[model samples]
Target chain A: MDVRHLSLPELREVIRRGQYTGPTPGLAPGYAQANVVILPQKYAFDFLLFCFRNPKPCPLLDVTDVGSPVPRMVAPEADLRTDVPRYRIWENGVLKAEVTDIRDYWRDDLVGFLLGCSFTFEAALLEAGIPVRHIEEGCNVPMFVTNRPCTPAGVFHGPMVVSMRPIPQEQVVRAVQVTSRFPAVHGAPVHIGDPEALGIRDLAKPDFGDPVTIRPGEVPVFWACGVTPQAVAMSAKPEFMITHAPGHMFITDPKDEELAVL
Target chain B: MDVRHLSLPELREVIRRGQYTGPTPGLAPGYAQANVVILPQKYAFDFLLFCFRNPKPCPLLDVTDVGSPVPRMVAPEADLRTDVPRYRIWENGVLKAEVTDIRDYWRDDLVGFLLGCSFTFEAALLEAGIPVRHIEEGCNVPMFVTNRPCTPAGVFHGPMVVSMRPIPQEQVVRAVQVTSRFPAVHGAPVHIGDPEALGIRDLAKPDFGDPVTIRPGEVPVFWACGVTPQAVAMSAKPEFMITHAPGHMFITDPKDEELAVL
Candidate 1:
């Protein structure tokens, strides 16, 4: 079955029913997919502020009301506890369990945040004829922790983490133009060339995800990665945290075009 | 004294000392003046979501940590509790007091938010040779409550409020081009012509602020007003609310040019 042809509700239903248990890349093609973060109400304010301060890495899509499982704005009918393909439960900043649903661990104080994911912008890049190295290599995009510190908000503070793509030197301008259109999803390149400038020592050894080939004519372009917020949240070592494991994203009803500003 | 000549720190010190008690208009020229809203932390999450939902009316510039008096991003050294020239205190949705400073009423649970004001974009308009009718008339800008309902978040929900200026039909495109550059400050006009289309029965009698004249050839242009969030916050009738009194904004360290995107 082609998941791209399925509607948002249908796609979410499949995930909810445990029929789909895989990374959501290329699923529900035109719909927006989000990075998920769930924290107790006590930490909601700081996390929200963290997203606001570091918009490039944490462009907030929608935040569920405290104790509520439904995301009123983004996906009214979907349940945050059961809608995603996979969930990672973190206890005191350490990953404790991976599950298909978090219903057993649901708490009244939990506040869910849906952040804009780069998958939306990757689709935009492909449409604009810019090559995405990770897509070509059939692997996760390379992500590295940079020396740049994110603007701190309360307990959340950490260095910025960025995802890298190797773009031909000639098409760097086009890559920036295409990604700029999607500010909600890690818009524009943070650094177009020179990985060392951001304090990344080795391109071949990424902190997360698989490293893609960097051709001689290609320049390594880096974008503020969605992982920064989750990483920061983890560093704070909150009593509890919940997230969609890696690329197993939460799909929303909003179309990818809905996020475009111009 | 020419307020434009004064440095940001100097201007803030004057305002803090209560020596400068006038409206912030044309004061601190080239610096960004912000619409202030200080609310109890209990209602902060809802209000933050409200601003995020309605970016046009409430383009959030900076938000302080709970119980903190400093606006760390926009005006790090300025004290939010007393830096503004005047403040309006509300209790149960009723105006309780209008004071020069809010230091006496500051609480540990309070959170300060600095929202972008239209003054920055207005300055851009004037620089582009487009005449702002209200500035020309030497009176407050006319504001109206439109029939359009804002996307609500939690307890904060209300109709969008808009400020109007009469522009010659020939310069409408230029007005849009100039204003679009300052998305942080209300961005482009929501409606360009025909007041009746927005359910605005009479242009002369505004819902808030002073009314400006609409000349024979000029069109009534409406942009989302900064008052929407404050009005929405007031409508929720929280136990407490604080805001800048009309034109008495909180001047920030950010320059007018910094808010422009291009």
Candidate 2:
């Protein structure tokens, strides 16, 4: 099945029934996709504070009521424990298990947070006729750990991680303007030309994701990445955490334009 | 002394020294002013979630760390305990005392939250040649309790409160366009032209703040007010709560233009 034309509920149902467990990049193109983070109630305050303090990297979408598997604001009809394509369970900062469903791990004291992802803004950039190198190369966007420090909150703190895309010099301003419309997603570029200014030493290698080509007349534009919260959370070394595996995301009900401001 | 010429730190110092306990409308004109909410650590998470779910009425500016009075993001040099000119201490939803300082009541487990106020966008509206009736009349803006229910978070739920300004019908669209630039403050009008639509019975009788005249050619425009969170928090009847006296806001270091998007 192509699966690209499925409705929001149909797509969630397909994932819920264990029929699909793959990357959700283009499956539901217009809808907003989210990065999931589940933590115990004790650490929920600090983790939320971290996201609030560092909004560029962690634009929070919706937070579930404690111990409930429903993200009330974004997609209340969807069951978080089974709807996502994949889940990574972590214990004491270490990756413990990868599974399609987390019904067995769901506890009464857990809180689920859904954060906005860059996919929303990338769609906007493409619509504006700006090239997104990773989409053009048919691979993951390059991500780098920067020297920029995130504001420390309670038990959460770390350096910001940013995703890099190579855009032609003339189109850089357009890219910034296009993405600035979606602050709910990572809006605007954090850095434009110098990689070393962010203390990122090499373009060929990245702390996460695949490296892509930066062609002539194109410059490396960096955006705050969704991977930041995961890295920061791991650094905190909580007793237990659950997140969507790389490339596996939770699809939301609202269209990408719904997140665009003005 | 004319307080308008004082810098951010100086203005805070004036309030800190108990020399200024009056309403802070025109003083330090360019900088942003914030509504203050200080709650015990036990209720901080729910309140933050409440603010997160409802951005228009409660656009969160910055939240202090647990047991800390310093709002690290907005004004690190100022202390929440003494900077605000006046504070209302509440016990079980009832007003306990109205004082100039909270140091005597401050506890190690309290967290301070700074929420964006309409003052930021009002300046934008004024700069755009839009008439703000309250400022013109030298009185508080009219506020009405709306039928619109805010998306409820855990232990927090209530109707949204809105402040009204009568804009000339010719400038309603411009009013929206001007205010839309600052989402950090109450962004855009929630309703326009009709009070009955928002379940407001009488323009002369507002739930809070003094009602202004609706001129022959003017339309009453309503924007989500900063009072919603305080009203909702009071409705929840937590053990203890502290808030800035209405119109006496916390002055932030950033100017109004800094909150503008695009």
Best by DockQ: 2
Task: Provide i-RMS per model in Å.
Answer: 1.5, 0.8
Top candidate by lDDT: 2
Model 2 has an lDDT value of 0.93
Determine the backbone clash count of candidate 2. 0
lDDT of 2 by residue, B1-262 (tens): 5687887788889999998888888888899999999999999999999999999999999999998999999998989999999999999899999999999999999999999999899999989999988989989898899999999888899999999999999999999999999888989889988899999999999999997988898899999999999999999998999999988999999999999987
Worst 10 residues of 1 chain A by lDDT: A1-10
- Window of ten residues with lowest summed lDDT in model 1 chain B: B1-10
RMSD of 1: 2.0
List where candidate 2 sits over 4 angstroms from the true fold.
none
Residue-level lDDT tens digits of model 1 in B40-110? 99999888888887889999999999899899998878898889989999999999999998889999999
Docking class of 1: medium
- Contacts from the true interface found in each model, as a fraction, amount to 0.40, 0.75
DockQ of 2: 0.82
Please report the candidate that would top TM-score against the real structure. Answer: 2
